[model samples]
Target: MIRFFTTIGGFLLGSLLITLLLIFALNPSFLAKQVLSYGAKSFGVPSTNKVDKFLDQTIIDGAIDSPLALTYLGLDSLNFLTGHKSKLGDYSLEKSESDYEENLKQLNYLSRFNQNDMPEGNYNLQIKRFSLDNDIRGYESFRYHSSPVTQFFGAHLSLVEFLTDQHKVNNERDIQFYFDRINEVPRVIDEIIGFLDKRAESGIYSPEFVYIKAMGQIDTLSTGRIEEHPLYETLEKKIDEINLSKNKRENYLGDTKDLIREVFIPAYRRLFNTLESQSKNAREMVGVWGLPNGNDYYKHRLRIYTTTDYSADEIHNIGLKMVSEIQNEIRSILESEGYDISRPLPELYEVLNSEERFYYEDSDEGREQILADYTKIQNEAMKKMPDYFNELPKSEVIVKRVPVYSEQSAAGGYYQSPALDGSRPGVFYANLYDIRATKKFGMPALSFHEAIPGHHFQNALNIENSTQTLWKKFGYGTSAYGEGWALYAERLAIEIGLVEDPYELIGSLQSELFRAVRLVIDTGMHSKEWTRERAIDYMIKNVGSEESEAISEVERYIVWPGQACAYMIGRIKIMELREKARNELGDDFDIKDFHSAVLMNGSLPLTVLESVIEDYIAESKT
Candidate 1:
């Protein structure tokens, strides 16, 4: 009887072990393959064992939440919720550090990986990954923790601000999300305050002016009667828009009102208290140059933004040279129009501004007309694209006004990312806040920069790339490459004869000159101890932008540091590489093929881009 029972137990144990082995053998490799397949699906590329190994290592390295990676994966919303909450001046240093460490590990892994054994396409993807990791790590070492500029700026005009402005009031779920976010604001504010406090202790506080400007925005956002609060308006409107049962709707409305009464007002009050406290202690200096190791911080910013080791002095010198060259070109154009060459550049800008032919008045009709004209311009430009680009974006493009409330602080124009599913069109937001700023003369080049063959082209192509991972499709595109491509696109328009009018040509040159000035002024304020006034003044003298515009641009450079330098530096590298290809391939070189080579990979660091182009040149030659 004892032997019979022992035999039965042994049989059961052996069967269980065999089952476990089968599960391990069948599922483990399949799980690994699924993970690789998911990455491949995200990038619209095919799966391979090499990609599987890379994906496995990515999971092991734990950089799934890196900002660039998250952006690339169409998981920006998730990343924002987890890593960045929507609150004025709120940022989390602890999270940033964690992200940094993970990114560094991933980068190190990529660096050590055997790239020689990988396919060139896979290696290209790896290079982009490394570039993104390097950029994030560079920012981590700099003044990234010093202030929350995006939040501070967004507090003035962001999606939330837009919702508020639209008076979105009716949906119960909408109200709840509103109140939920509102209740969360104070906690977010506390986190931000904690970050600022640490920076202050380390002598890394923002200029007093920034806090003053921020406080004004806060007051503007929160000053209305409680019922009239922007937050309340947004809750009310959004709630009304959603279809729900009457009973559920009423209950949600009541709960939302109660939450607003009990939670939101107090959250704003807490945020106000924090900002008011910081305002008192804020320093007067307007630039990061005041901080310890500030110069080094600025230099690091330049390197990261430009993806180059060019010094502030080198950029500054380049700006001076370009200013003279652009001026000469402008003079030649003005002379062709019978204007005196001896006249100042500012005078040319003045003439351009005052001419009735150059502007539409600030009326709704005028705005519509401008939009129509921009559309017309884009249509005309699209007809000429085969002259340059071999490939085009699958996504459609539209021109729209920057929403009224946010237009004040928004740039002249910006491209909204296309939907991952391609349900929505890529939008080029033209800031018509000050119609004069959107002068008619600037439309052609501006259209080229923001719409057709500019951001819309490059960014949409990235999203539509079927040969890359969702991460590669969305992730590793750098600002230098992206913005540089747009800036270069502006030049491409000139090359394609899109800018027919000399004034339009001047506008193109002016835009290029603006980027050149940024290279100088960004480096100057951050690395050379140039004051805000000096940077602004230099811009006015050289770039011919309005004083107000110049000041805003200068202030942006102060907070953003190296980002401004990406445009020209990136454009120069691309143009240089194209010229190299043009020279090497000579009769064999196809302009369309050259463009395809540059843009087909989406955005890459200048160094990686050079390699891709070199390969293209070699392949084309053969």
Candidate 2:
């Protein structure tokens, strides 16, 4: 229930999971409509073939077990799925272990049907099998290292992020569902702590810095000020917005305050205490390499995130090469503009960042302007989508600031997918914790990467794809595929004339340089055993990164190994594929068709994505 959206959820839980399993049982006509929605008419229909049916069942089972995902999909809007609204499902290590065991059984069952004859079946069966197998391997190998609590993402932050942003209330029944969810926090935190205890038994625990940061976050949240807590504020606001009597509204607010004080605040304190104890046993090293079987764990992470068999050494070298090349490109741009090239790289960056025009005032008004400018940038980008994409999503993307309380450790920017029922538009969350950290030059690249033609574009298209099954349209996992596409989107803007200023062009290249430097620094810290300070220094010197930004990025790589490598590695593969397509197809290759080949399949393993593009080339040649 907690990790219902990660790569683990993709494989062990079956990336093919689609909660629409009940469609055929409840309404055949409706099922037919869904199946025919996009004309191929195969994915939405449950196959009569036993092999296909078995695959469908595994995916459906995983979805059913995740009430949190169901709610995110707006399943609560459906009469059939609303049962999940009042539950958080199981959020324990015991549950994950059992789920892993069940996946093993499911994998074995799948092999039994491989030789079965059928006229029709899943065309992407090999990819599906590969994904599930990969999931099983990671689950067996790295479960201890893959703690549910990290500074980057964990129950400590996710509970607040999800409840405030994702959970919605419209009526009294919805309000009741909200309260039922509030009452589930204690059990979830206890379950998370139980998992932490098990991980500690294996000598795997958060670094002291991480646990300290987590403890601070928990303390901020669990301050016992019910009136001020985001949970109370959000729900109370919802209660007031709904068409309810004054007495009913007061009763709801009073009940919510009780839940916050009695259930939530206490649960957070328990979580805080657990993390406090873990810090004492925490390892001193920054990398997972310091843990039991840490070397193999890092390898597993690279394979999953990059979706390729790239060794740490190979990735490290790639990073070094790209970093040098990108820095030259940046210098050429700045030097042409008559800036001194003799200064240190960080000094150059310092000058660029110091420009008064590049930053807004460090005030509330400035933060609001950042959000507004981001929206305007995204809106303008939408104008060009029709020329680049044959199929554009109907779902709109919106810009918002990261919630005030949790922005400290949050990434500078990120995207959240829309609610499946169209109740929510996709959101691009810019971290405005420090208004000074967000410079104007970086806005265009960040906007494109996290919003238009980046995450929002790909994700919304996935949701709107009539031909894909519920699984493909929902949560097919692979970080490289998604992050790579977004990274590529940043450069695509420069290619297509979206970067309107010389400084903006520098921002785009600097962003690319940042990702490239990640490859070197991430592998350096995790594989070469570089210290945290060493990695931070490398980023600053190489990428001309702000010290605070460098520190944040380095620490992020510490907790989430292999993820930082995904952006550059992914973008490289995508660019290579585009060139490959263009070279072979000659005049036959259309950019729009190439995009369709890359994106229409939803997030894919780089290997699988290559195969898909190759097929597109072959079809075009005919």
RMSD of 1: 6.0
The whole-model C-alpha lDDT of candidate 2 against the native structure comes to: 0.81
Give residue 56's error in model 2 in angstroms: 3.1
Write model 1 residue lDDT over 423-469, tens digit each, in one string.
Answer: 55788878787777776778888889888899988888777778654
Residues 1-622 of candidate 2 have per-residue lDDT tens digits of 4466567646555444444556556654355433323332333443456655555555555555677876786656443433667777687877887978887887776676553353432344555666777789888888788778877788878887778877878789888888888888899999999989888888787777888887888899999567999999998888788768989988989998898898999999998998988889888888888887889989988988998899999999999999889998889988999999898777888788778998888888988899999999998898998888888878898998887787887889999998766889999999988776788988999999999899988888887777655455543677899999999999998888899799899989989998999999999999999999899888888876667777777889999999989999899999999999999999898989998888887678888788778888998999
Candidate 2: clashing pairs of residues: none
TM-scores for the candidates:
0.83, 0.91
Runs of candidate 1 exceeding 4 Å displacement: 1-42, 47-91, 121-145, 150-183, 225-265
Models, CA RMSD each: 6.0, 8.4
Q: Would you list the C-alpha lDDT of every candidate in the order shown?
A: 0.69, 0.81
